[model samples]
Target: MIKQILPSEVVAVDVREDPPEATLFPEEEALVAAAVEKRRREFRTVRHCARLALAELDVPPSPLLRGERGAPIWPAGIVGSMTHCAGYRAAAVGRSEVVSTIGIDAEPHDRLPDGVLDAVSLPAERVRHAALAGADATVHWDRILFSAKESVYKAWFPLTGRWLGFEDADITIDAEAGAFQARLLVPGDTAEGLYLTGFAGRWLVQDGVVTTAIAVLR
Candidate 1:
């Protein structure tokens, strides 16, 4: 379980049942009927994890449909994101205005695949990697940075109607407090000057599991 304390309100959550196997949706969601049986099952797991996450909100779960920009809308007024790996399923949710946006993700804790930093980390962050040659610090920092970028996107994308690459935001991780921070670099097509001053929460990487959450604030 994790709690994301923002300036307005806090979002609390727990990781739920993870699919025993990898799940993937068909490229053609509209023609799901023609999808392979295994593909259909994967889609079901995605929907189920999403719904279960929303259950933590004050709003009752309803059919959540994706908008043109890929944001989700539920009958109840809330926004969130959920992701599950072979062994973990996680979600983050918040009510609008009162709360901006929330995203949660889980990954297995193995040495991050080599060279992913090029795609997922900022130039300055990459320097940190260079400095921590043999320390656990470097590896965990890499994970937190990757996680922060993902959370920022989930929080920003729905409201802005645009997508942000990992390089679009600069991230800072506070290891002792178990929290992280982010700042907009390009701001791009997002709300101008919409600075992400801070993101506070807990993250754990143990026994081959890595989980984190982020909640946007006022």
Candidate 2:
């Protein structure tokens, strides 16, 4: 489902169940050893997916260490993102030359908890969500919107090394086309230069899950 929304050059690996043979390297093990069992399992499983994605790009399975902000530090010349949710874990990667930055997120097909919509979205976004929900009550658009903002922030932070609150990006969702756009209300820099505008992305709700992805080329 996620692969359908990413660029052709991007390789995405997804797993619905934990990889039976997954194992973390020494460094990775140290980072999560103190974590709870569930956290350790999810971390190893997602990293397994990441390794598979990198392998698809002909890159070896190198140690994926977390940066200062807890973001994965990719190997040189590679740009990628990873996400995991209930029963879903995935990672997408591409050559840095092809994709300067990328972000992907997954969430269960469920409504946000009470008041979360108001807290994470602007007034206009809530209005749009109400309209969308009225038209199609089957899928949870609010959660999808939240996931989209997460992807945007993941992509934004790598380039700018700064924080992007949910309210910082005004997102417009096009349910009919299964797409969305985000207008950045703050300034940020990209590999091409400073990009204070926005980002275009693709989204999908399938198999009881909502997935969103954004890929920015140089």
Best by lDDT: 2
Task: Write one digit per residue (lDDT tens) for candidate 2, span 1-218.
Answer: 79999989899999999978988999999999899988988999999999999998889988999995899999999989999999999999999888878999999999999999999999999999999999999989999999999999988988888889999999999998999999998876665577658999999989999999999877
| Candidate 1 lDDT tens digits, 1-218 | 44433333644444445355523334325545777865555455666656555665656545655665556564456667765555555545666656666766666665568888788887887776556433454345676667667777776776576777777877766655766667777644446446444345445565566666766555
Model 1: which residue pairs collide? Answer: none
Worst lDDT run of 10 residues, candidate 1, spans: 22-31
Cα-based lDDT at residue 108, candidate 1? 60
* Per-residue error (Å), model 2, residue 44: 0.4
Give the Cα RMSD of candidate 2.
1.0
TM-score of each: 0.74, 0.97
Runs in model 2 lying further than 4 Å from the true structure: none
- Give per-residue lDDT, candidate 1, residue 168: 82
lDDT of 2 at 169: 98
